[model samples]
Target: MLSGVGACPAVSAAEADTTDNAALNDANTTIIVTGLKPDEGQNKISQSGALGAKTLFDTPYSISVIDAEDITRRQANSIGQIFANDPSVFSSAPSGSTNWWGTQIRGLGVRNYYIDDVPLLLYWGGDFPLEPIESVTALKGLTGFMYGFGAPGGVISYRTKRPTAEAMLTTEIGYRTSSVFYARADAGGPLSQDGRLGYRVNIGGEKGNAYNQAGINRLVGSLALEYAISPDLKWYATATYEDSNLQHEPFQFYWANYVGNSLPRPTYDYEKLNVANSYYKARTLAAATGLDWTFARGWSARLTYGYTNKYHRSNKMFVYMRNQAGDYDGYAYNFAELDQNHFGQAMIQGDVMTGPIRHQIVTGASFQQTDSAFGYNDRDYYWGNDFNGNIYQDQPFRVTRAIRFGTGGWPSKEQQRALFLSDTLHLGEHVQAMVGARHTRYRLADLDGNPLVDSGYRTSAVTPTLALIYKPAPYASLYGSYVEAMEPGSRVGGEYANVGEVLKATLSRQYEIGAKYEHRQFSLTLAGFRIERANTIDRLINGARHLTQDGLTLYKGVEAIGSYRFSDRLKLGAGVLHLGPSIRNVSAGNEDLRGNIPAGAAKWQLTGSAEYYVAAIPGLSLHGNLRHSGKAPTSDSNTLYVPAYTTANLGFQFNTLIGGRKVTFTGNVNNLLNAKYWTQTNIGEGINAAMSVRLSL
Candidate 1:
């Protein structure tokens, strides 16, 4: 059973400011907490973290904070691995035949990724690296009301380490199976005599191999600078670069008729068959600068600008064996493709306070452009009679030589412009309200100078959100919200019949209600939400064309999370999630996709973690985690399924003094039992175990 800490009396509206002042004075003696502090009293309710920082424990939302200590304890090498312990979140290979992992939240896709307070639009196509991050925050549910133009799924914000007043240096090296190697170094301090100016730099690289014989290699680096021009104005800039070379494995699917069957299947030599003959290369660079100013009274303003460029190329080879007279021989089917993109954005935000009402406002405009070019070259080879005979006997064969060339053209470009505004109002001591809206226009252009069918075609949409928060006391709060969102449609394959027709944006609506409770040693939250979408895109039975008019989908679910401290040296965390059935409606002529559970939507999920201090040995601790995911349908048909599975992990940490200097050592064993299970039955792939060690100074 969980017990809640009683709430404190709500401060009167007239005395709220006085109460804040007193709280601020009391905090002066306490240690400053980084990345969790509130901005100011006037910005409290409307601000993202404005609510009492410590009171986050009381919020009724599915939230997880991967703090610095967790980062070290888990030996996390990338952002994708950081949330592996969270039951609701799942990581899988990208569908585009790449090595990158697509992290999903509550069965919905995450579209936007943020660094610090700025948004990074280039999360896809394997652009950014997870190194150089100090911590990551995962917020579930509709946060569009706070961040603007985000997925209903959730948002991940990564906060990078900044130069501290004190100088520091750190480095690490590690190795794993398949000759994998990892190395990283970071250093920073004041660049000038005055602490007002500072600079920090980071560099890292990795090379490794996967269980399937695929190779991975990448290099990552970043630089940041901060300057305080005066007491009221400040500026900061950050830049990052990443390059990766990866070998990809093709997906395999089994026949639906084969279920719970045991047979000694023939194992083909993957290397000999060259079944996974594909390689991808990508490079990305991005930079951002921000200016902040404080005015007289309780007025402040901020402006930020960012730009990114990404390039990718891939080569794939297909192999097939044909039986002629008697022997087996190999034939090759190959293709090569390339893609490039450039993105830029700018935003301005401000806040102000009036007599009894405090208003937090964010108004900004942004533009993004993406250009891609794809042309494939193919080859075909034939084996002689000798090899054909081997094939007849079910013997392995290899492609001696072949030559073939094929050509197809795919050149496309897209442009988008958007503007958004939001305001949060404090009605009184116990109630707060927030309302916001956004407008966006999108355009797609053809490769030739001539206008594409949908060229110059424009669609505009307005999304609004409303929220009410009632905090009767300091330790508990209840909230409910209604939000509207939309996803733009692409003009691919000339699907839109009315090229000149102005189409409205596809729209989605979400309704949510939840409550939060917090105590000195425990916290809990329970939330329920429903989401509906219209004009969802779908394909015909033949899969030759797409129909824009036949798309509709609905998703609803309940999520609950809690954390409790059992003792001064022990703690526990747990969560449970249940998603309702998803439904789709379409014309009868189309594929039979009605009454099917949504792909990737699990019915039940659970996660729990425990931590304990080793009283017998000082400075030693142990941690363990367990995760379970329920069965899920593979596709719209819902005929095929992937059975549920659970995994466990264990680790240990120790703190000691080396030459009178503080140091920490950590080790972890992921997949403690080394279980073999398929996450996606349709995709036919599985993840193996990993062991890692790390030292921090």
Candidate 2:
């Protein structure tokens, strides 16, 4: 069984400094493990922004971790694939989409993501190669107190692979459906004999045809270096580069503006259609450096700085159905944008005592700046006529070759600065209380020199968090928490009356209570949560659509998940989530939208997984997964719906020794039944397969 393949949260700087070297040495000895280790702390919890670490039973948050082993076993190539079985996360795009990273957590949209605890300013257009990542930590609910400023959807952090104490090398090759092949190499060792200086390097590339005759190509590389000056001080740096292209990709369908109240059937055979002249290209370069120092016993401090530059360009069509006959108008747009981010954070944490109360205090400051600019040669071209083609027929690039246009010249800049502090008081052995707050200053400027956004927008807010925990036993606990968060409002698109306008910052709040149990062979977590926030919506005013923020959006849900190890050879895991999300208190032309379910929010979700080890064989195992999502509203007004769907996956792995070195092989058939389904309300996904082999020396 895959006994040790569950969430293994995170660790603080001091805790990592004490355990990483030893753990790395032990990890390289085997490609798989039969059971969990005592020191793994699989359910421990730590905030990405250097918050002090705590065991899962003591922390007052819902968190999950996906490690490298799980990534390899599942052959996951994108963020959506990594969390497909998680009931709480919903992806809005398929893996091949340029905006695949867009997701909704607990019914709210996620606005930011982190790399090695440093927040990067990303919207819906970035993806990292999984080859060099160590783990991914997903913290659910509001995060303003632990983090500085963000959406209420949750926090996601990625930790990159690091140098190992012992010399090691591994090579792997893989194949996917439709003639895709790839290879990768990972090597790490100490540059100095004393093991004080170490380095790790990874490189990979892939190129092949995709399921629907689309083409895919990718190249990625990363390097990480660590230097330990002494037992109490350490410094590290990391750099990564990725370039990828998706050719002949499909576009998202939009029918709200064209149809009154009609829902289209999901009958398009995506596996056979090839829409030419539609492609996406992205290039990313990023670097980060950090220092960790243990100044005294039970006291530590950390400082980190990171920078990212991302460029993406795409030309894709948007389809708008006209009538029940499926006739549609196709509009293609050529778009390109450049985004740059600079981020820095400094933090200190330590333990102190006052009489009988023990306090763990943490304080930090963080700042981020982002600059965005659009290409000058961008263009939007229309086909010859309004009704160009039908959805059931294939449209080629030649149909729009004669149309020409040019669009461009827009830029915006944003800055955020925050100071945060938290204290967790240990009241005796069974009770604890925690309080935290973050004071943030945010500003957005329209660099386009347009009067539409006069002096831009400036705001300040103080978000807070409070929590209480009671431990009935060392392995179980009950806790409750409340948090407040903030996010900058979205910029109005060109089609809206308020183009180039920047709205005021939005505020969100959340309340949660949960219970957790982690014993010898089983683990369980149950939580109920409620979130409220204001959203940006567009309404027809005076025959023109204007973007405005009004009313409140409410999301209340219950989640239950657990895993059990029935024996040495069998393991099972399952989770279920039910969400009640709606919009309320709207006036003007949008009163009809009140009490309607929001788009992309599923009312119910269920997931199950199983892994079994062949006790008769030395090193062989089988695994399977199932996921179901209920029907979801396709629009904010609930006039359109996407029906419920289910997908399943099956796979197996084998490990053996070859030439006195460890070797492993794995294979998987995703969508084993070749289920035809929709990833988003309008995006479709097809069946695929993957197989790989790895050799360690």
- Candidate with top lDDT is 2
Error of 2 at 558 (Å): 0.4
What is the C-alpha lDDT profile of model 1 across 353-470, one tens digit per residue? 7888877565666666656543422232211232222211332333334433222344556666677776767777777687767666666665432443545545566777777778
RMSD of each: 8.6, 4.5
Model 2 Cα RMSD, 1 decimal: 4.5
lDDT of 2 by residue, 1-697 (tens): 1111232221111112211322232222223333234535334444546345665555687776776777787787766667766778666565555554467777677766888776655563645778788777678888888776777889767778999988888888998877788999888989998999999999998888765456779999999999998999999999888898878766556654656454555553663233675667778877899999999999998888999877776565566666666667766555566778889988999999999999999898888888777643324322223226766676654334532222246667778899999899999999999998889998875657463774557888999989999998776788899989887777766456776676778898999998877666676778899999886676777988788887788999998877776765677788888999998777756788889887778889898988776656646778888888788876687876667888888998776666655667889887787766654424555678899998776
For each candidate in the order shown, give its overall lDDT on alpha carbons. 0.54, 0.72
Candidate 2 weakest ten by summed lDDT: 10-19
- Candidate 1 regions with alpha-carbon error over 4 angstroms: 1-63, 78-80, 94-101, 116-127, 141-152, 248-277, 316-355, 373-409, 445-454, 491-504, 535-549, 590-592, 681-697
Query: Clash number for model 1?
Result: 12
Cα error, candidate 1, residue 585 (Å): 3.4
